[model samples]
Target: AIAGWTPVLDVCVITGEDGPHTALVISAGGVVSDAVAPPGTPHLRPETITLLSALLIGDWAVADASPDGARIEARGIVAAYAQFHLERSIRSLGHIDRTE
Candidate 1:
């Protein structure tokens, strides 16, 4: 969680029937008092908390669109965060230079 941000965002990645699923635990009303999530949720802290919080606050529509639920669900929050917030559109990274 970033400084001055609440209600204590906790994220988790769990294997589901389809694949990995991201479970979010958000504190109620941005307050810590009612922050307890439902049972079986993992306690996770994002490495890039400020960036993630900014993304969540600004670009939720882009962030929610993922190929697979598992795609955005990872123990490494950076990948998930980047895929959702940083990625602009799908594009080929490179093309084969087949002149050999």
Candidate 2:
């Protein structure tokens, strides 16, 4: 039984070209947590954080106005993360032998 196993959503935002990135994790219980970058990782500016937060909350207005590079990087990161998470979850459920 996969007890207490709830889906989690992780979002990462990159400030700009070669800029620092920050990640946020939201659990199925609606709990939000911040994921810090490892040591030596560049720190993001307060404005960058705010912009990313807006993007995270579905603020299309802000997203539409954001720099192209930043927006594109954010989208790519999100897509990659979603794919990896989905694959991991499917694998954890075990494999089924279709051949009888």
Candidate 3:
């Protein structure tokens, strides 16, 4: 079993040409999983599927060059995830120290 916090990130991208696309990313115990849907995927607007697709397919150039709202959202998600994990790890270490 994965013994760690798993945060789900919802990233949306909106551009002048394409509408909006959304991608759901989940990271658990160093394993990453994601899913991207095209336009008209229930409550999500079609935007960032292109960016997610690029990342999924290992198109670094496209993903890196993406200058859209998705990029900002992605960065924020990563920061939050890192902070959360760091805090959790620190707390876990403190508990271990107290017990020992």
Best prediction by TM-score:
2
Sort order, lDDT high to low: 3, 2, 1
The residue pairs in collision within model 1 are none
lDDT of 2 at 97: 39
Candidate 1 or 2, higher TM-score?
2
Query: Which candidate wins on lDDT?
Result: 3
lDDT of 3 by residue, 1-100 (tens): 1344533223222222232323332233221222334333332122344554565557999887776676655544445456665664333333432221
- Per-residue lDDT, model 1, residue 25, is 37
**Candidate 3: clashing residue pairs, number:** 6
Provide the TM-score for each candidate, comma-separated: 0.23, 0.39, 0.34
Off by over 4 Å in 2: 1-36, 39-52, 88-100
The candidate, 2 or 3, that scores higher on lDDT is 3
Off by over 4 Å in 3: 1-58, 88-100
Candidates 1 and 2 compared: the better one by lDDT is 2
Deviation from native of the Cα of residue 54 in model 3, angstroms: 4.6
Better of 2 and 3 by TM-score: 2
